[model samples]
Target chain A: MLNYLARRLVLALITCAAISVLTFVIIRLPPGDFVDAYIANLASNGSMVSAEQAVAMRHEYGLDRPVVVQYALWMGRVVRGDFGVSMMWRRPVTEVIGDRLWLTMAISVSALFLTWTIALPIGIYSAVRQYSIGDYIATLLGFMGLAIPNFLLALILMYAGFRYLGLSVGGLFSSDYAQEAWSLAKFWDLMKHIPLPACVLALAGTAQLIRIMRANLLDELRKPYVVSARAKGLSELHVVLKYPVRAALNPFASSIAYLFPYLVSGSIIVSLVLGLPTVGPLLLQALVAQDMFLAGTIVLLLGIMTVIGTLISDLLLMWIEPRIRLRGRA
Target chain B: MVEQVMTNPGAIESGGHMLSVRDLAVEFGQDRGSVRALDGISLDLRAGRVLGVVGESGCGKSVTARAILGILDRPGRLVGGRVLLDPGTSAEQNLAALDPNGAALRAVRGGRIGLIFQEPMTALSVHYTVGNQIIEAIRAHKTLSKAAARAATVELLREVGIPRPELRIDAYPFQLSGGLRQRVGIAMALACAPDILIADEPTTALDVTTQAQILALLRRLQRDKGIALMLITHDMGVIAQMADDVAVMYLGRIVEFAPVRRLFAAPRHPYTRALLRSVPDIRAVPRARLATIGGTVPHPGARPTGCAFHPRCQEMIAGRCETTAPSPVPAGLEGASCFHAESVVQEAVV
Candidate 1:
């Protein structure tokens, strides 16, 4: 097991290296850099810089250097815990991302928690009582959840919250608490604001997970081991939960590999519509402004999260299933 | 319905029968209409005796076992029947009448009665170790501590002839060979020490050598424990070797039932006679044609009007066999559901 884990860790490091290289290259793929966007903004305001001044600005920002040299310099600084400065915010990229990253993680984690807790039970119930009225109702609602886009759901929810509850249901904090430092009141306010966006974000994932869990459980319920479990005089609940449900959970475990990356990146449009102060909006701003340091760092972090998620998924699968564990040993 | 005479009157008179399935009928609902899968099937399983139920596929052999255990798959249900399980001390209870999902039936299953499956490969759960599964079965019906259950599981593994019980107990189902897996299945069935064991084609998925070993193990266990064994199979050789009493089924009904020796010695029903003849003789002339029944078993939806086997029987009375179903006739300790059972025997003798 140690050997297997060591091998996986090595593989993960290699994958993260590839992702960093790719993120760096992709961020540079656009025609112009942050300097070009800055110069264009100055010209639109009827204020222009001389060619010599523009060259001085590029040189100061290291944009005048070759791409390879710039990459090496940036990578060396990144290795030493420096993400450079965000050209858009004129601050350190780490400072720009710090609190927003936490808020993003907070919302995503809560959404994921809501998804599994709601989806698993409903999925198991739908499968065990297949074709029943409850099953039919769940199926209908699940399809609706999947069909409606996240941004649309966010819009509908925001309207509903404002109209009926008389509550301002946008962003991660109330206007008064938005700029406050850490406090119980601000944390409570943040908590109050989390559910709306979390629910919006979780709807599609929950619906898809329900469908996947239901289908997998349905297939497993017909297998002979289920009959064997039943024949052991186990109650219907015990039989379904112990045997088929475990077998059905395989897909759920492996899905963790995608869930992490999805939670970070998939919330982009939803974050935009809901006006949640998350890393998603910051990344979008960085990318649009061609702030290579900020955009590349965000992309690289997403990639690293994906690699870690895959590793966790593999370890979880090995824990749950003996077949995979033994195969890993061999 | 014709009044069918019950076979095995001697066992019934002696009050030795542990499980009795009487007038058991099952039906499956399809898109168009319902088809009767088991039609008034009756049999008796006595203590320390192996009752072999032999038939071709779709003859409702497996359905009979499932119905008796109250584990029939969906779209199929017990339309009418009484599965009387006598524990020899208390009043006998009709298992068929018990609510399928109720606690009473749950206690009866794997508690008072156990069932072994056909396919060993799929019968056990791959997620659990063999030891864990057996321990779960043991604890389900008994009030035992975890350590006690684990000890009992190890003992069961040893009882079923698995080598190095301590280590092999931790192995998953996929790690074991087919024979060893079936042994694990047997250990699971015998975990709670049930009064009756219903093996549904237990050896059908095994090779000949493994089949013999499993049969031997089953016989030894049955004898030592005095458990009533209901062995369902399609192999005549298995029936001959393992069964004390034989019940021959055709189209969801038992056509003939007798002691194993008597069934082979003086087979009465034409179906049973054909089944016996179809078994290849080791000393027969080389390069000779093998004997086979004339046609396949008919679909249950399109059952013939009279005797189900008449279409394939040589002695089928033209108008009589085609129009009227024959009630079972008692002959000594055996019985056959055929009008020309005696004639078939006489013709064979001639």
Candidate 2:
């Protein structure tokens, strides 16, 4: 088990390196330059700086160096917690991404909870009472979720909120976030804005989850042990939950490692639709402007998030189920 | 209708019959006319005895076992019958009469009568370790602590003669060999220590040597545990070795039920006689032809009218055998459900 873990850790490091190299290369290949765009923005504003000054500014940001040296320096700074300043926003990339990362985490995590917590039981019930009215209804709902694209769903929800409730799904804190103390009321107001985006994001995911759970449960219901459980005098509920459901959740449970990626990537689509202020928005802006350092940092941060998600999923598997090897105990 | 009281024999005694099944019939559906899975099937499985049910494929051996466990999939059901189990109590309950979702029936399954499925590979969960699956089986019925359940699961793994049970206990079902997996399944079934164990073709999926080992393990467990066993199989040799009482089923009905010795020695049912002759033996006269129960079983959907077996019977009497169904009747200390039970066996000379 130790050997296995060590191998996995080494593989993880290799994966991280591959990701950084890919991100760096991809950012370099994109057309245009942030320095030129900045100089143009300045020129349009009638603040004509000397050519030497513009070159000096570029050098100060180390854009003067070749790609490899710049990457090495950037990697070195990353290792030392000195993520470079944002090219477009002109703020330290870490400070810019930190708060937004936390917000994204909260929203994604909450949305994930809502999806699994509700979908699991519903899917199981649907599978158990399969071909019944309940199943048909769930099936139809699942189809709707699958068919309606995320951006459209978000737009429809946004339009409906205004048309019916006469309310807009925005205004973080409703009095500006600075005045809020992260109090319950402030959080509730914050949550009101989140639903439109979160629901839009979760619709596709929860639909997929329900389908997975239902198909898995349907498969498990046919197992011999399930029959054995029923034969053992256990209640239908107990039989379904204790034996079959636990077993059925195994594949999905293993995939929990990938959920963070699902959350992060899936959030990008919904984030764009909602016009939310998150790392994803900044990421899109950085990419469009070819701000390599800023875009590279976002990609790197996402890589870190992927690692964290995988670790959590692994630990969770060991905790919820003792069958897995944790640091090689068995 | 009479429940268990009228059907079960000698209910008061300790060694009395545990289950008395009578006239149990199962069919697929309406348009797809039901196959007589268990036609007028009557038998007694007493405490502390092994009843090996033997027959060829589609003979309803598995159907009988599934009926007992109440685990039959859809389009298959107990259309008519009674499963009277003693339940180690004075009041023998009619298992058949209970609703599918009844609490009483739930209490009986996996509690009083445990089941061992045919495919051990498919029987245990791939998701959990062997130990966890066994622990789940234990904890499902008993309210043991997680630690206690784990320890008990490991103990059962050891009890089934698995080597390095402590280490291998955490291994998944797929990690074990065929023989070990079967042993694990045995341990799982025996976890509850029920009065009856129904091994539904337990060894059929395994190789011959592994099959022998599994059979021996079951026999040993039966001897030590004093639990009645219903060993379902199509192999006559296995029945010969393991059965105290043997029942021959044909077309979802028990055509003959008797003591293993009596039935094999003086087999009454033509199906049983043909099955016995089909098995190769050194005692057979040289240049003699091997007997075979010629013809396929009738398609379950299009069952022949009257007797379900008449189309295949060699000594088919046009009117009595084909036009009229014969009910179960006594054939010595046993019973054979055939119109010509007496005439067919009277001239029987192997």
Candidate 3:
């Protein structure tokens, strides 16, 4: 097990290195650097920066160096917690990400927990009482949830809140609480506004989870081991939970790899529609404005999360299934 | 029913029968109609004895076992029956009359009567260790602590001939060979020291050598533990080797049942005689076609009007066999559901 852990750590490092190189290359693939975009913006605004000053700006950002050297230099700085300056925001990439990363992660984690809590019970119920009225109702609701786009749901909820409740419901906080210092009122306001965007985000995921979980469990419930467990005089509930449910959860557990990156970089359009500050819209803005350092950092962070998520999923798989753990040895 | 009660000499044994199935009937609801899978089946199982039920596939041998254990799946319901379990108690209780999911039946199942399935490969949950599954079975009836249960599990693994029981206790079912998995199944079934152990084709999925080993182990366990074992199989040779009493079934009915030696010595039913002849002898002429019972079994949905075997029976009486099913009658020390039992016995004597 220790050897397996060491091997996974090495593999994770390789993945991060590959991702860093890929992110550097892809962001730099487009023609012109941040200075070019800055100069073009200055010119479009009927202002001008002298040629020498532009060259100085290029030198300041190390755009004058070869792409490989620039990448190496950036990677070196990143190792010491320097993410270079965001060309558009004119601040450190970390400062630009500041509190937004925490908020986004918080929301994503809550949405994930919510989705699983709702999906697991509904999925188990639909499968155990298959073809019953409850199953049919859950199936209908799941299909409906899948059919509705999250951004549309956000827009609809926003309009309904304003129209019917006569409330401003776009941002994650009220105007008063937005600029207020951390206080009981601000915390309460944040709680009140969390449900809308979180629900909008969780809807599609919960639907898919229910369908996948139900299908996997249905397949497992038909297997002979389930019958064997039942023949042991276990109660119906105990049999379903202890035996088939563990096997049925394999697909859900493996989805952890995708889930980490998904939470860190949530639905950009939904975030835009709901007027919430999250990493997804920030990443989009950085890319549009040609802020290479911020864009590259965000993408690389997502990559790291993916690798960590996969490592976690593998560990969880081994923990849950003894068959996999004991497979290698004679 | 009266004739059955009168002819069953083993019913008068001192300890009484461990399990008695009288007029046990089971039916499956098909798209076409209800198909009777077990019809008026009666049998007696005694402690420390093995009852071998032998028949072709779809002859309801497995169904009978499932019926006794109350593990039959949906669409297959007990239409009529009485499973009288004595359990060497003050009063016998009718298992068939109890609700399958009620607490009373739950205590009886897996506690007093245990079942081992046919396919060992799929009989155990892959997610659990052999020890965990066995521990689960042990704790189902007994209130042992987890550590105590673990000790019992290792002991069971050791008892079943698995090496390094302490280390193997943590091994998953997939890690073990098919023989070991079946051994685990036996260990789980015998965990509660059930009064009756129903092994449904337990060795059918095993290789011949492993089959013998399992049979021998089962015989030893039955003798040592004094548990009534119901061995269900399609192999007649296995029945001869393992059974004290043998039941020969055809189309879901026990056509003949007797002491193993007596039944083999003077088989009365035409089907049983044909079945015994179909076994290839080591001394048979080298290149001859093995004798086969002609024709396939009738589809349950399209059963013959009277005797289910008449269409393929060479000794079938045209008028009598076509219009009426034969009731069980005494033939020497055995009971056979054949109208021509007297003639078959007389011919054998001649």
Candidate 4:
């Protein structure tokens, strides 16, 4: 087990390294850098800048250095907790994203929990009572959830919330509490504003999870062990819950790698439409505005999360299934 | 609907029957219609006796086992039947009459009756330890503490001839060899000391030496525990060795049933005789081709008009056997479901 953990950690580091290189290269693939965008903006607004001042600015920002050298410098500072600076926001990349990071994580995590808690039972029920009216209804609704776009759902819900409940349907909090620091009332206000966006984000994921879990469980329910378990005089409920359900959980556990990153960067259009302050919208804006430091940091963070999620889920699978652990150990 | 004679209760009871199945019919439904998989099959089992049910593949041997245990898969309906278990009392508990999911049936299932499946690798849940599974079966019918159940499971493992059962207890199903896994299956079935132990093709998946060892272990266990054993297999050798009574089945019905010695000595039914002849003899000339039954068991949907086996029987009566299904008729201590049973024997002698 110690060796396994060490091996996974090394693999995770290599993955992060590859992700960092890719994020850096892909973010720089645009026609110009942040300096060029700034200069163009200045020119478009009919502003003049002296050549000396422009050169000074380039030198200060390390924009005058070679691309490889600039990447090394940025990485060195990143290891020291400095993600360079976002030219668009005129602030350090970390500071610019720090506030949105917590809000995004909160919504994503809540949405994920909601998706699982609802999907698990519904999926099991649908599979166990296959072709029944309840299963048919769940299947229909699952397809609908998968078919309808998250952003469109967000728009529809926002409109419904405003029209029916007279509720403010966008942002993390009401205007008064938006800028407020932590307090019971502000927390409550934030909680009240979370449901619409979280529901929109979770719909597609929950539906997909239901379909996957249902299919997996149905396959497992047909296994001989389940039949023998029933023949052992175990109640139908006990047989389904204890035998096949554990095997069915394999598919769900394996999805964790995609799930963590999905929660972090889900429904970009939905985030934009709902005006929710999440990493999705921020990453989109940074990529569009040629903010290399911000885009690279966000993508690198997502990649790191993916690696860690995979490691955690792998360890979890080994704990739950002895077959995997024994195979790995051997 | 065809009127069928229910098993005679007095005759079975006089034979010391522990469980009696009467006029059992099972049907599997598809889109077009249903086909009877088990048709009007009856048998009597007594404690401490090994009753061998022999048949070719897909001839309803496993189906009979499942029906007795009330574990038939979906779309398999018990159209008519009564599985009566005499629990050392005047009144017999009708398993077929019990609600499949009800408590009474559940109590009878793994408590009074136990089942060991053919494929041990797939029968035991791979995710759990063998001991854990055995303990589960033990606890299913008994109100034992976890520690007690664990001890019992270890004892059972040891009894089934598994070496180092204490260590092997924690091993998963995949960790054990086919024979060891089968031993675990036996241990599980015997956990509750069921009066009737239904082993459905238990050694069919094992190697020859392992199969003999398993058969020896089952015989030893039956001797020690005195449990009624129903060994279902297609191997006549297994039946000859282990069974006190032998039942030959074909096309979803018992073609002949008699004491093992009587069955092999004067096999009355042509199907049973053909089955015996098909077995290659060690003393026979090596170059000679082995005898085989002419045709396969008829498909359930396209069964022969009268006797289901008439098409394949060499002694088939053209006009009579093609138009009417013969009920089981007695010949000495044996019974055969063929109209020309006496003539078939006389013809064989001539």
Estimate, for each residue in B301-321, the C-alpha lDDT of model 2 and write its tens digit: 666877777887776788778
lDDT (Cα, tens digit) per residue for candidate 4, span B139-168: 888899999999888888998999999999
Candidate ranking (DockQ, best to worst): 1, 4, 3, 2
Q: Which stretches of candidate 2 lie over 4 Å from their true place?
A: A36-60, A171-188, A262-266, A311-330, B1-15, B28-36, B87-90, B126-193, B207-210, B213-217, B220-227, B282-299, B304-342, B345-350
CA RMSD of all predictions: 4.5, 5.1, 4.7, 4.6
DockQ of candidate 1 against the true complex: 0.79
Error of 3 at B323 (Å): 7.5
Against the hidden reference, what TM-scores do the models get? Answer: 0.93, 0.83, 0.88, 0.93
**Which residue runs does candidate 1 get wrong by more than 4 Å?**
A41-46, B1-15, B30-32, B87-90, B310-324, B328-333, B342-350
Instruction: Give a tens-digit lDDT track for model 4, residues A163-202.
Output: 9999998988899988888899998998999888888888
**Can you write out model 3's per-residue Cα lDDT over A1-330, one digit (the tens) per residue?**
677778888999999999999999989988988888888888999999999999999999899999899999999999999998998888999999977888788788888888999999999999988888999999999999899988988888889988998866877789998988789998889888888788888888899889988999999988878877877887778889998898899777788999989878888999999999899999999888789999999999999999999999888877776665656211
Pairs with backbone N, CA or C atoms under 3 Å apart (clashes), candidate 1: none
Residue A288, candidate 3: how far off, in angstroms?
A: 2.5
List the lowest-lDDT window of 10 residues for candidate 3 chain A: A321-330
Query: In candidate 3, how many Å is residue A192 off?
Result: 1.8
iRMSD values, candidates in order: 0.7, 3.1, 1.2, 0.9
Model 1 over residues B95-172: C-alpha lDDT tens digits? 999999999999989997899999988989999999889999999999999999999999999999999999998999
